[model samples]
Target: MIIDVLKNIARFLILSLLQVLVISHVPLGSHFVLLPYVLFILMLPFETPKIIVLFASFVLGLTMDAFYDTGGMHAAACVLMGFSRTHILKLISPREGYDNVMKPTVQYMGKTWFSTYALILIFIHHFVFFYLEVFGFSEFFSTLLRALGSTLATFVFIYIVQFLFYRNDKISI
Candidate 1:
């Protein structure tokens, strides 16, 4: 129990710092925003309580907001992602269902599943984020273009990071 807590804490700090300090600095043009910090929220254990997931996501987003001064844009998006996570998991759950200890990492679920999952969440997050940032639909196509651009970039970045960094969960079968 304690170990899991510590690991999550480490993940939060490391990812948050990397997001604020490093990833945020890598400008992918004006339209593309790299959002690798979200991987931390998306990779939480499948069995994690909903409240904890929502709370953690809020904290993570708020931390990024603190760095970027985007008010609660990230926090709102994080909470939206957290709210949608369980539904997405249910939609993609295996035929045998999930193990109590299962995590929604590419290392555990494979490329296709994780790709779909991540892309959907990223698109939703980016859509809300960009739209909310503008708070209007006057520049609909332009906002959408920016959101899509950032979504694709963030998704690719998260996918690569998962492959290179996250450990493959051992299957006991």
Candidate 2:
């Protein structure tokens, strides 16, 4: 139990730092934003309580907001992503349901399931984030396009990270 908590804490710090110091400055151009930080929320164990997830999500977003000076935009989007996580899990859950220890990772869930899962959550995160950043529907289609493009980029990066870090199979290298 304590080990899991420690691991999660490490994950949060590493991912958040990666977002602020690395990915944030990658210059993906105006349309595509990469937010691998969202994976921190997505990869939480299935049994985590909703409130904890929400709190963590808020803290993660606030950290990003602190760095980006985006006010509360990231916080709002992350909170919404945390809020919708369980529902999305349920929506994509197997007929037999999930194992208690199962995590939402490509290694455990397979590429297709993980891809589907990540895509939806990333889209939700990106859409809410970009829209809130813009704060209006003035350029509705452009906002949608930005959200979609960012979603795709974020999804790809998240999956690659998951596969590289969490995959059970040993690579020969």
Candidate 3:
């Protein structure tokens, strides 16, 4: 328990720094924005309680909001993402059903399952975030395209993060 908490703390801090200091600077054209920070929220242990997950997601988004000066968009999107995670998990779960797995990871869930899982959540998150960032219908198509592009970019980044840093412990839930 203590170790998991510490790991989460470090993950939050490290990813936040990467988002604000590094990835945020890269020019992915005008429409797309890189929000690798959401990976922290997505990669959270599958069994994490909803309240804790939502709270952690909010803090993570707010941290980024503070850096990016994007009003409350990040916080709102993250809270929504956190809230939706369990439903998405339930939606995609196998018949054998996540009973043996402790958390979602490429190592435990396999590449395809992890990819689908990441893609769904990342698309939802980016869809909400980009729409909220621009918040109007006049630019709807443009915003939609931006959101789509960012979703793909963010998905790739999330996968890379998992590939490079994720550890598979195979804990029984």
Best by TM-score: 2
Candidate 3 lDDT (Cα, whole model)? Answer: 0.84
Better of 1 and 3 by TM-score: 1
Residue 5 CA displacement from its true place in model 3, Å: 1.0
lDDT of 1 by residue, 65-150 (tens): 89989999989998898888878988988999999766787777878999989998888888898888898999999999999999
C-alpha RMSD by candidate, in order: 1.5, 2.7, 2.4
Better of 2 and 3 by lDDT: 2
Candidate 3 residue pairs in backbone clash? none
Task: Give, for candidate 2, the lowest lDDT window spanning 10 residues.
Answer: 164-173
lDDT of 3 by residue, 89-117 (tens): 88988778875344688777878888888
- What's the C-alpha lDDT at position 53 in model 3? 92
What is the alpha-carbon lDDT for the whole of candidate 1?
0.87
Better of 2 and 3 by TM-score: 2
The clash numbers for all candidates, in the given order, read 0, 0, 0
Taking the tens digit of each residue's C-alpha lDDT, what string does model 2 give over 39-90? 8999888988999999999999999999999999999999999999989988
Measured by TM-score, how close is model 2 to the native structure?
0.94
The positional error of residue 13 in candidate 2, measured at the CA in angstroms, is 0.4
